[model samples]
Target chain A: MNIPPAYVLTLSGILFALGVIGVLIRRNAIVIFMSIELMLNSANLALIAFARTFAPAQEALRGHVFVFFVIAVAASEVAVGLALIVAIFRSKESIDVDEVSSLRG
Target chain B: MDWQDFLSVLPFIIVAGWATILLLVDLWIPANRKGITAGLAVLGLIAAIAAVISRFGIEREAFDGMIIVDGFSSFLQLLFLGVGLIAIAQAYDYLRRRDIERGEYYILLLYSLSGMLLMASAGDLIVVFLAVELLSIPLYVLAAFAIPQADSEESALKYFLLGAFASGFLVYGIALVYGSTGTTALSGMVAAIASAETTPVLLFIGSGMILVGLGFKVAAVPFHMWTPDVYQGAPTSVTSFMSVGAKAGGFAALLRIFISALPGAAVMWMPLTMWIAALTMAWGNIAAISQTNIKRMLAYSSIAHAGYIFMALPAAATPEVAPEAVRAALFYLVTYAITNLGAWGVVLAMEKAEGSGLTIEDYSGLGKKRPALALAMALFMLSLTGVPPTVGFMGKFYLFRAVIDANLIWLALVGVVTSLISAYYYLRVIVVMYMRDGEPEVRSEALLNSTIILTAFGTFFFGILPGLLIKMINQVGLLDLLR
Candidate 1:
């Protein structure tokens, strides 16, 4: 039994929307990080679904290839982002985005 | 993959290879004796510039169609290399003054410049995504380089979070675009779109998402919430470098993607840009007037400039106007880079010890104390306001001309009106400097001062004799490539 690519795409779209909403509402910097990860994962899923939808059987692998690159980039971003968060945490003693308001007008 | 690819990307190879080697070499250098790194980076930039010059007029697709060497990339590469050199010089003085001069900063800058150069030439969406990440990660690290400052760290965190979020959007957009077009290559996508009479809805949505991501990098209004805080909270040197470097990279990709790849969908993108450009100008100018902090003020002012650059996009849709549109863009970036970097150089000159002397009030009485420096600042402010006898005016003239030619006269009018609104704040800086009475003296660094004088000279000299640059832009065929 084969699953329709539309279902995968629909699921990915829902996940991406949820991720965007989470980012907008989340206050904690860590939670924001998680939200961004969710967004990236949804993009990965969408790419995979699209890859399968393309006519050529070999072309579908490009989506999987793109997914690998996304995961690698996401990991690196998280590494540097977490380190930056720690630096901020050391200085301000809080990871809440609200507390990081010293920069605003 | 071939000798042609190697020659095409010679400059990129030179910078990336030099930077990676330097990063390893930096580990052996004594921590306190780190000034050598900057000298090495300067040498690498000069070498990279030479490579770029050598590759001129040798336009071709290389690196498996992921990159191209053309008049467009050549023009932008020159600007990025120049920006990298000035940023390094500015950083040396800034870091020395703060007693935080380190090898890693220059290394990071070279890497970022490599990424920017890559963006200038990237012909594939995957390459664009990779180049953006390469450019941004270094910036995030550099923004927080002043680890001791709580503000710097906070700036990094905010920038990183937002940058990553933007990256997610970019990738998702690319994915959707690929899904619709069945290819991630820009040239392929364009061909695909051309073959289809009506653009698929997915392509339009994907392009919009992609624009949102690029808009954030260029700090366009509504997406620019990260800008002021990051500019203010980051160290001045990083802020100044990014103001030009990041903006240019974003515009480079934007120009290639929209103007080069999707000219077929003008009806879809142009109106959206009309709205974005108008709002950005309005918001950037209006908000700049009330800012007390000079960096934040310039940040808003930079946003206003982005809108101006963006105003040229609609004009780029037509084949006849595309070359003029591109020339206007290249000229605008060149002139703005010179003027903005000079303005920031003056800001750096006026910088005192950490966390003080950064407000607009710091410029009070600068005319009496340092007439030359104040004069330089005043010139930059004038140029930024699109006043005559400065390159800023010339840049705007060409941009507006291009817009009018595309029948975007209303957008041109908006540009003129907002430039009028912008003048009030830009002139206010001049007012505060010469008119206000305080003992504001510029701290003179030989390198920083020279950069300021050179940029200021270019601003005035180019404004008076812009035909020379116009000839160069024409020679680059910046306008001729679109048809």
Candidate 2:
């Protein structure tokens, strides 16, 4: 229980802020994707850190296992997401998120 | 380790296996025989349905609590497979007509259906996330399947971007909930939440965020901005799939998560959902009346129906009424899927060979020229309007009864009033079909005719003998699974 809870929470907070900023300011769908990854990673960091700090030793590994799954799923998401972006770019000739507004009324 | 466990997930495995086989076949088969691809997809869907029926009522957990193949999930899986079959059938001709008849369309749809089945059966948070992405990724591709249309590409991009953001929020919520409860199993979380132990405030925050994320997926009013645009921009067949199939999957996941995982915290979230239900119903119905575009109107109408479904959630949270409310919700879902798919099938049939027949004006005089199509559309509209003798009416009756049973008479009253208002817009389509005078050009296209006629028959058949459908739905023991 000697681990610092404050530091873990602060990291999560910072990562979340970065994700929000990335979503709001970035035009590239790829960067927006990376920001989401950052957010999920921060969440994983907090989950694992808390598990280590508070849970029994026997259960500490569960947090890391969950995190691994999260990472695996994130990788799958990236593969599919980027492929979709590439398909869109090939069809529309651009990747600027702002320019893709054919759905607007 | 149990063979029964594998049997529990057999339908999903069958679909995934079919998708892989289709992918391999696409490599060898000539591109001209795209109809064969459609036939294969339909066959796969039928096999999945049969698997679900054979395994129905066998409540069991598989993959170490990651997937639950219980009655609830089986019911939803059957619904998703039914929607997939209809969509694939419709797409055979629709894709060919638009000259986008690649074998990949059916393959992607099968893969997406597999994802939806996974979502329906997911028992843990991690499983939920995986199933959601599996369901969504293929849809992104399908949305923009029309490679030449700028609007199709835009729809795909918008859906993907927003869908990704929602996933981020959902995962963050899952992480926080896991951190607070020390478990990812939904039943475990429910036990923790219901106990008198000092629940962490973080759990509440995480659950709230998850609700927001899921609300976006179901397209409740405040989070519904993307629905109309995405629906209108995507190809009609894809739109039909999304409106019926994707929405059903989203609701299935939402019900599983919220009703099972967060039932103890109903007081905190039920009010928010109630308002969302009210607003979505009013907004969708009112806006639909003003819409000249049939696609846009259906988009609004679909949003409105989402609101009605949301009404069941708050009631399902109540301990005294949870079981009946869940059954009512499931019944409503089945009825809604049939009626909406039928309605969209008519619209798809009406779309001109080259141009999209989306405007309400395009439907004028349809009653006279194509009496069968118009009558089918009328049946669907009447059902949506919640008139008696239709499954839609029975669904509303059951749902509102549950709401009132939970002592939320005010919410039920609001729902009834909204259904009354909804009748105006629903009947408007019928009025235009019969009252307006114009030359209705009947397109005797085979695919359109088959899909429309089949859906029309289903609408009336289910509308009259709703008891049979409800009995089938009730046979699925969702309450035991929830426990």
Candidate 3:
């Protein structure tokens, strides 16, 4: 049994929306980061689903290659992001996103 | 990839490879002698600038069409390298004074420059994504370079989370565009899009999402919440480079993607960009009037400038006006880079050891204490306000002309009105400097002073004699924009 591409894309869109909401509403830095990761992974899922749907094999391979790049980029982002979070935590003794608002207008 | 492919990306390779090598080379350099590292970074950028110049007028697709060498990329490469050199100059003395002078600062800057170079040449959506990430990750680290400081660390966190979030939207948009067009290579996307089988809805949504991501990068209004906070908190040196470099990088991608890849969807995106440009200009200028901190004010000013540059996009969507719009935008970017870098250089000079002397009030009596510095700052403000005898005026002159030519008269009017609004705050700096009274302590480091002097000369020289640069831009004005 094959899952339809539409279903997968719908799920991905939903996940993306949820992740955006999480980022907006969540106060914890790490949780907000996880939400961002969720959004990335959701994109990856949509990419894979689209890759499976594209007819010509080479075109599909492009999507696959793009996924690899995205995954690599996401990993690097996580590395830098967590380092920043840790640094902020150390400086402020808290990782709450709301607390890091000293430089406001 | 073949040698030609490598050669096409020669500048990017040199900058990235030099940065990587410098990372190791920096390990052995003594802490006090990090000036050597700064010098080496300058050497690398100069070499990269040479490479970029060598490729002038040479247009070719490299790495299976993932990147392209053309006038657009070459021009921006020079600008990025130029910004890199000035950034190093700004940082060298300032970092030493603040006691955060690490070799990594230059390396990270070089790495970020490489990313921007790649961005200018990216011919595929995937490469665009990669370039954006490559450019941004280093900036995140650089933002928090003063890691022990709460403000710096907070800046990094905010920039990181927001940057990552923006990229997520970008990737998803790419996925949707790929799904709709069945291709990620920008050159091929047009062809795929013209084929009747493609889904227009998905493509529209995808392009809008892509715009959202890039809009965040360029700090266009409604998506510009992070600009003031991040710019204010980050080291003034980094903020200076970022204000010029990252915004140009984002425009490079936006112009490339929207004009080259998805021109077929112009109807859907044109009005959207036009409205965005108007709102960005209005919001940015209006908000800047209320800013107390000079950095934050410049941050708003940068956002306003982004809006002005963005006006070229919708104008370019008109086939008859495309080339001129692109040229106008390119010219404006150069002018903005020169003027903004000079302005920030002055800010860097005024910055104190512990971040005192940054408020606008600190600039009082600057004319009396340091007339030359105050004069340079005043020139930058006039330039930013698009007054006569400044490159910024010429930039806006060309830009407004193109917008009017495209029948975007209302948008041009919006630009004019916003610029007038911007003058209120920009001149306030001048007024305070010459009109008020306070002893403003400023650093007079050789490199920093030189950066300010060079940029000031460029601003004044180009403003009066913009013909040479305009001719140069005419020759290099997106010759392959439709290819």
Candidate 4:
């Protein structure tokens, strides 16, 4: 069954909304990072979905390639991000985003 | 890439190669002489500037249009490289005083600059995404370079999380634009947009998302929540570079993509750009007046400047005015860079180790303690306040003229009012410096002293005599902006 591109885009949009909500609602730094990853994955989903319906098979093929690059960049970001979390945890003795409040006015 | 295309991007290639080579060379250098790494980086940057100058008027694309070499990008190339050099000079003493003078600091800065150069030249959506990440990640590291400091680490954490979230929006926007137009390259997108009859829903949504992402990068009002915290938390040197370098990269992407690829859809994005510019100016200027911490105050001022620069964005909707608007924006960025860096140089000189002496109160009696530094600080404040006989005034003149020419009279008026409001806080720094009397404990650093004086003189030089820069701006404007 061929799913309409609009339906796929809608699903991606919903997932993106969930990720945004998670970012706003979650207090844990780790969870927030996970939410960011989720947002990126949702974008990846949209990219591939749109690629599927793109005319000219080769143009669609580029979309699939784009998803791979996105995943790779996301991985690098997570690696650095988790290391930063560890650094923050060591210094502050907590991973709670609320506790990381030394910078505010 | 063809040899000719490679020649177009030679300056970029040189800087990227310089950074990579420095990474290996940094290992062999004895730890105590980390200054050598900075020297090498500066030399490389100068060489790259020479390369950019040599390639003037040569325009071409490489890697099948993933990157384009053009006059506009060359102008920004020189700006980023110049900013990077001054930042290194400013950071030299501060890092040593704080015990964080790793050779890697210079290396990371060079790489960050290389990324910004690419952002100015990127011709495709994929290149934009890559360039943004490449530019951003090094900054994340540099912001937290003083890892022992909890505040530095926290700044890095906040910046990373928010930055990642923004990247998601940027990529999604790219995907949707691709979905609507069936192309990823901006040039191709432009062609597709011209062929299409009306602006599509998917493309409009895509452009809005893209604006959100760039907004966060440029620190426009709503997306600017991370700015003050990050600016205050990060080491002053890192904040210095990040403020000017990263913002330039973001604005470069915005100016090029919107003006080049999406001017046809101005009816969709121009109004949104207008509101963003207006709200950003009002919020940034209003919020800046209350900050006691100098870094946080500068952070707000930078946001206000972003709004002023963005005024040129809406003006870009008119093809007749886009070139002038962009030229004005470019001129403003250059002036702001010098004045802001000069102010930060004074701050860096005055700051005691472990982030002491950062409050505005710390400037009391600075005029008595370090008269030269105090005088430099006053000059920078005057420039920031847009006082006459300074580059800031000329920059604002050009910006307001373009906005008025485009019939954005209200926005231009908002800019004037905000500048008036901004004068109070900027002048307050001077008032405290000259009028108040308390012993200000300041560090003595020669490189930073020179930077402060150089930038101060530059602000004056460019202000009274803008003809030199105006001629260069006319030459370096986007080649096809009128097309």
TM-score of the first chain alone, every candidate: 0.92, 0.86, 0.95, 0.91
- For model 3, residues B1-483, the per-residue Cα lDDT tens digits are 888999999999999999999999999999999999999999999999999888789999999999989999998889899999999999999998888999999999999999999999999999999999989999999999887887788788888889888998899999999999989999889898777567999999999999999999999978899989899889999999999999999999999999888988899899889999999999999999999999999999999999999999999999888888989999999999999999999999999999888999999999999999999999999999999999999999999999999999999999999999999999999999999999899889989999999999999999999999999987876668776
Cα-based lDDT at residue B38, candidate 2 = 86
Spell out the clash pairs found in candidate 4.
none
Candidate 4 off by > 4 Å = B197-199
Local accuracy of candidate 1 as per-residue lDDT tens digits, B377-427: 999999999999999999999999999999887889999999999999999
Candidate 2 C-alpha error for residue B87, in Å: 1.0
Question: Which candidate's DockQ is highest?
Answer: 3
Instruction: Give the DockQ (2 decimals) of all models.
Output: 0.72, 0.55, 0.87, 0.74
The most accurate candidate by TM-score is: 3
TM-score of chain B of each: 0.98, 0.96, 0.99, 0.98
**How many residue pairs of model 1 clash at the backbone?**
1
Which scores better on DockQ, 2 or 4? 4
TM-score of 3: 0.99
B323-406 per-residue lDDT for model 4 (tens digits): 899999999999989999998888898788868899999999988888888888888888887888899999999999999999
Local accuracy of candidate 1 as per-residue lDDT tens digits, A17-61: 998999999999999999999999999999998988875765566
Model 1 docking category = medium
Give the per-residue lDDT of model 2 (tens digit) for B1-483: 788788878999999899999999888778888888888888888999999999877888887888888888988998899889888877877777778899999999998999899988999888887787788878888987885678787788778777777777887787777767777788777777767342567777788778777777878888788888889888888999988887888888888888877787777778877888888888888888777788888898899989889988888778788888888888888888888888888877787766567677778899999898898899899889888777788888889999999888988988888888888878888998999998765556677677777776766777788778777767774666567
